[model samples]
Target: MGDYFIKALACGDSLRVITTVTTETVREAQTRHRTWPTATAALGRTLTATMMMAAQQKGDEKITVTIQGGGPIGAIVADANTSGQVRGYVTNPEVHFDLNAQGKLDVARAVGNAGFLSVVKDLGLRENFTGRVPIISGELGDDFTYYFARSEQVPSAVGVGVLVNPDESVKAAGGFIIQVLPGADDAVIEKLENRLKEIPPISKLIDAGHSPEQLLDDLFADHDYRVLQKHSAEFYCDCSKEKFGDSIAGLGTKEIQAMIDEDGGAEVTCQFCETHYQFTADELKALMH
Candidate 1:
């Protein structure tokens, strides 16, 4: 009913699947950013991928995904941690367009296909795991599939979809990630490839009131799968007044004083959740020390 994702391994551990139903999450994001239909589609896809990627990790692990295409939508950024929290924003959320030939949201045109998709993961290591790949489709799903194959060397199929209502609200949003594991049987791969080709759009599945577990069941209908874990996903931002204060402090004493002198205080709004945090001159002065 809200939003959730399930992780599982199937075909004798020769394949990995992550299925998510993200309608509510995307709705919240659209409301927060006031994203149009095309922008909503682009952002929703990226957020779905972020949720799946974070589900692969645990504890304090973190991940940041950035997509910069020269399209009207500009850049899309989403971050998630192992705690089932994800937040993101688009640089140009007001973008919209007539439906594409397929009668879809025309996400590729809005996202552009001229930039790169980058992922940075902080896994409690000295240096984070960083991956970058060119934006092949600007549709995000194909780009992420290519990212896994090209960057992580894992052959994957990522299907993310978002249906926008006439009112610009998200009608249904969801995604699935299927990866081919090492030494996978050729038969297994072939079977999965067939399923991938025949399966309906992920958004359609979610809109039909299917849960993540049910999506997996539909994908691997013939083969029995093992559920690894399930997690609640939502539009979550960790920004706070103190975090904004620290950022203001990082701007140094002079910038803090300038905020106090020029504006009498400071107002900062987070791009991810559109949450605003205000600090008065008194608060700014304290950060100056």
Candidate 2:
């Protein structure tokens, strides 16, 4: 209802599916970024896809997805943890365009298709896992699907969508990822491909009040499936003034003194949430020591 995701195993455990509804989460992002309709759709789709990808990890694991399509919307970045906390922002949030030929938001127009989609995974290891693929459609869903097939070598179908209201606010946002497992047969894969074509757009389904379980049912079509887990999703940023101060301190005493003498204060704004953190002259002085 609010914002949640489910992990499920379907088709006799030969397929893995993750479905999520992200309307409220995307609304929060739109409000924080003041994104236009087209920009909202682009960023919302990226955030939804990033959350679903992170859901595949374990505790404390994280995923960062970045898309640079050389479009009017500029770069899109999203970070998500296994716990379902996600935060993201677009470099240009005021972009908008007329609907595409399909009578839907022109996401590809805003996102462009001249760049790349990259994913970085932090698994609490010395080196993070990084995968990148060329941007296919700039519609986000197909781009991510390509990432799985090319980068991860897992045949996957990704369906992500976002619908904005007349007032430029998020009306609905959601997505699903269906992956063919090791044991899946060609018949199962072919059936899934056909079914994906028949189902409505994910945003439409979410707007029509389709739950995650119901979404899986629609994909599976009477096939048996088991729900593995349910997790609530949210837009959360862990930035703080203290953390920013620590970063500034790492700049060393000379830089701190320069800020104290030249500006008397410093204001740092987070890219993800746009929250401003201020440090007074005295605070900078303390960091200098």
Candidate 3:
């Protein structure tokens, strides 16, 4: 199935939920960064969570999520907009580790336990909104849940998972976010919590051929959830050769001349999607004029 995300309301509008299937997205990331199993899990989880958060915005608003954990994987950054576009990268993508004690990918070790998860929302205002919280757990899902409760002051549950193949490719990747809005009764919260604990991991559910709507049904069970909207999600990058060329032009005349004298040419590569742009000597000369 194509990558997609869904938003729904349950418990009489007292709860908001988002879910996404991102297997293809994660695969594209792995191919671009050549990430190992552990790195794939870490980056994939962050991308999945960012996509869900972006769905909360309106119009051209966008959200950028940055996880700077002092671990082998370095920093993980992802940006997603209301249009369902997402792009991200890891500072160090070659990091890998054996399964943890639970026989699961060792994401905590790859991401470390000390750091911060910061979200910056560009709402087309003079000052954008920003929220930050300490990383309570390097597993990512718990860290995001903590962000919601502490930073946003909303009780929420986030489940993100990525399964890597034996050859270090992505097998399955997806996630879900369920938040309790104001006036949520204790009984409703308890039922939702219980269901969350009983349900399988999000990645496993997607691998088992479950759709985003079905995942919500499993989370809400007998409760009625009204689907609000659905949108296709993918690993999309907005970088282009023309944009890089403009950046080169902005480097000023002196820097452009230095490039001609030293390197004979210039090459720019985007770290987000790994797209490379090369400028030959003739191209550089034209820019100099």
Candidate 4:
């Protein structure tokens, strides 16, 4: 599929597993942000993990994840909802470095080891649920794994990866999340952990053309699992001229007049998508109310 994720219950409903292939999704992000290989890998991993996290929520619920690692890449932010729509950006998109000892993108170096990962769940409540944890591994996958165990208090394993081609284009991007539910059998958890250790990296699996179903099958090799749901996903941003216009209007008439007099117009670019929206002098006057 172009881009999609699947949710399944394995080990007799004692464990919840999610898998996704996001090649095209990450490609779009790379093109939009012009991210280098290391930057692409970092942002792609964050986006994939955010999308999977959103799968756990109900209707209209949303999840926002932020990472700031005190590295050259600065902060990474991504948000997603139950509808499988995700969008994100990094503070710097051109940072890059040589591969690490394992010949990987060296995401940890670019992301740094000093910082925090924070998550906010908007459950349509009076106050959103927020969790923050120290950055354990700048590689992202381990960081998210730690997030679940410490923040949500759910024993979870998260794996996310991205591969960038020689031309700095995204080759593959995907990940998996396995959560051990209450009453999970100890033996089953041990088996699942062993299976994870044996499987290839998630990005390599995606590059090898493994579908979400196949990924779960690989993870639950000798075990039986039932697919619970599937959702189409994409790097989507809902920003619009009207939305930016409302923001400009919120700035009051005095600021609107300044744009008309000094610049003759105002150009607003979305940080996530880099899409620019221009408001001419006449348009600015229209929002002066």
lDDT of candidate 3 over 235-268, digit per residue (tens): 9999998888888888888999899889989989
14-88 per-residue lDDT for model 4 (tens digits): 999999998899999999999999999999999999999998889999999999999999999999999888999
- Evaluate all candidate structures by whole-model CA lDDT and list the values in order: 0.91, 0.93, 0.91, 0.94
Q: Among all windows of ten consecutive residues in candidate 1, which has the lowest summed lDDT?
A: 216-225
TM-score of 4: 0.99
Winner by TM-score: 4
Q: List the residue pairs that clash in candidate 2.
A: none
Better of 2 and 3 by TM-score: 2
Stretches of candidate 1 exceeding 4 Å from the true structure:
none
What TM-score would candidate 2 get against the native?
A: 0.98
* Candidate that beats the other on TM-score, 3 or 4, i.e. the better one: 4
Every model: Cα RMSD to truth: 1.1, 1.0, 1.2, 0.8
CA lDDT of 162 in candidate 2?
92
lDDT of 1: 0.91
> Candidate 4, clashing residue pairs?
none
In the range 67-106, model 1's lDDT, one tens digit per residue, is: 9978989999999988678999999999999999988889
Clashing pairs in 3: none
